[model samples]
Target: MLVVSTGDLMMFGISAVALIVLAYVIQKTRLGRALRAVSFDRDTAQLMGIDSTRIIQLAFVISGILAGIAGVFLGIKYTLYPTLGSLVVKGFIASVIGGLGSLTGAVIGALLLGILETLLLAALGSGYSTIAVFAVMLVFLLIRPQGIAGSNVQEKA
Candidate 1:
């Protein structure tokens, strides 16, 4: 059976729009700036009059909402299964590839991963696609452990 359908395309469009909106909110809103400040340093943000706890709570709520949306979409696309939670590996890989904490990186990484997976599936079959993806990720980590959008920093031990 074909996996791609009109419904899937519609869902993909909706997801894309949602992601774009989220990225914009994270990049251009006051809450986003506060979140960034908190992420950079909670103590400093607190000193600057930002409520770190509130920001953290808001972040958790936003994360939960997004996760719920993703879960619903996944259920609709692939149906509920015992191993559904394991599918998060793709998101983890994409996040790693794009850059651990960068919104733009995550979006780019996911898009690139999706394209790569589709190409690999067509060329090497489904069995080998995951292997190739992981192999590529390993090579990427070996060469650029900071990820595509992550900046290199020297940490003092």
Candidate 2:
């Protein structure tokens, strides 16, 4: 049987709320618009007087802050070790599975990966479950490299 603690529930709630707030900030703010523009095309954003350099800097700062917060949350939930950073591979896999640049896609991919991993672990064992997750990611790469929510974007010359 599976058991969940209040700490786990609180963590889930905090994570969900954080994601929602981030989505809102990305979708509905002037900073968000500038960020999207700069990310899409730095040259064009600069040409349009959007201060691409500043936006890029801000982006990095924001990412660093988020990463730090995530690290703290992770430490709260699990033991810290030198090898703990290796688990970031799962985040990479989830992002790729959902589509690289899409936040919603990443969330969906994470949930799907978690569900698949949990089911496999329950049925089989940890060894096979890890292999199966990798296999699933391989299939996604081969079949739909753009990911579930990613659209093919043509680069300008």
My TM-score estimates for the predictions, one after another, are 0.90, 0.94
Instruction: Please list the residue runs of candidate 2 whose C-alpha ends up more than 4 Å from where it truly belongs after superposition.
Output: 155-157
lDDT of 1 by residue, 70-92 (tens): 98898788968898887799998
CA lDDT of every candidate = 0.88, 0.89
lDDT string, candidate 2, 30-148, tens digits: 99999989888888899999988888899999889778878888999999989898779889889889998899899999999999988999998998988998999999999999889
Name the top lDDT candidate: 2
RMSD of 1: 2.5
